[model samples]
Target: MRRADEPDDRRTLERRALTEWPEQAGAQVRSVAVAGDRAEVTLTVNGHHDYWVYYRRGRVGREERVSGNGPTLGWEDPSAIGW
Candidate 1:
């Protein structure tokens, strides 16, 4: 370490800024809709990947679709419909 009173410099500040993280973040929803008991959703996640989620009653179906692993997901599976 430096002297007890050594002040930080611009390089240190720049490095800190580069390593800093944003205060808030979330997925950008692309689309969403509902019909009867079925719902559809699309999102671009910051960390995971894009996703299309389907829900009905309390049941839900989702899969990673882009920029990550898992199958290419789209719409709701037949089994995902209804409760």
Candidate 2:
């Protein structure tokens, strides 16, 4: 389980890498949020609209996947999420 307030740099890096998988070619990660073993990443695949991605630790760091994908999220601006 992951704590909301506390953060794990390793987990974030792992999740970020997972987000960049070949299947997501042309997509760009804009933001990342980790809560426990679950992760949510915002991206712009088409370079226009935004998308939200969901991932969870599979078998304790054995794998990661994009479980959910949809329209832009209801949060801060997309550009503010990352570079």
Candidate 3:
């Protein structure tokens, strides 16, 4: 159970290594928020905003827009979240 504000240096390094696409060159891990078996990895991919939702149960998804009824995994972009 990692806190939202925790510094995930090791994890960030690991994730950065995995992003080896040509288009993902220089992609930066902006933030990582973990809650139980869920995590939200925010990144700056090629100077563009990007994010992914990771679930412990071998499921992953990208969030282009906020939907459903609940708190965001870790994304906090107020403008993207439909209010």
- Pick the lDDT winner: 2
* Candidate 3 lDDT tens digits, 1-83: 46455456436533543454465466666656554434555555567646443333124433223322234644443344332
Write model 2 residue lDDT over 27-71, tens digit each, in one string: 666766665555566666656756665555566652344434674
- Over 1-83, each residue of candidate 1 has an lDDT whose tens digit, in order, gives 12112133322322232232343535545545444444444455565566554444333332212222232343344454223
Error of 1 at 25 (Å): 5.7
Taken over the whole model, the C-alpha lDDT of each candidate is 0.38, 0.53, 0.45
Positional deviation of residue 52's Cα in model 3 after best superposition, in angstroms: 2.1
lDDT of 2: 0.53
Candidate 3: global Cα-lDDT?
0.45
Worst 10 residues of 1 by lDDT: 1-10
Judge candidate 1 against the unseen true structure and give its global Cα lDDT, from 0 to 1. Answer: 0.38
- Candidate number with the higher lDDT (1 or 2): 2
Q: What order do you get sorting by TM-score, best first?
A: 2, 3, 1
Number of clashes in every candidate structure?
0, 1, 0
Candidate 1's displacement at residue 54, Å, is 1.1
Root-mean-square deviation of Cα positions for candidate 3 versus the true structure, in angstroms: 8.2
* Residue range with the least summed lDDT across 10 consecutive positions in model 2: 74-83
Best by TM-score: 2
Is candidate 2 or 3 superior in lDDT? Answer: 2
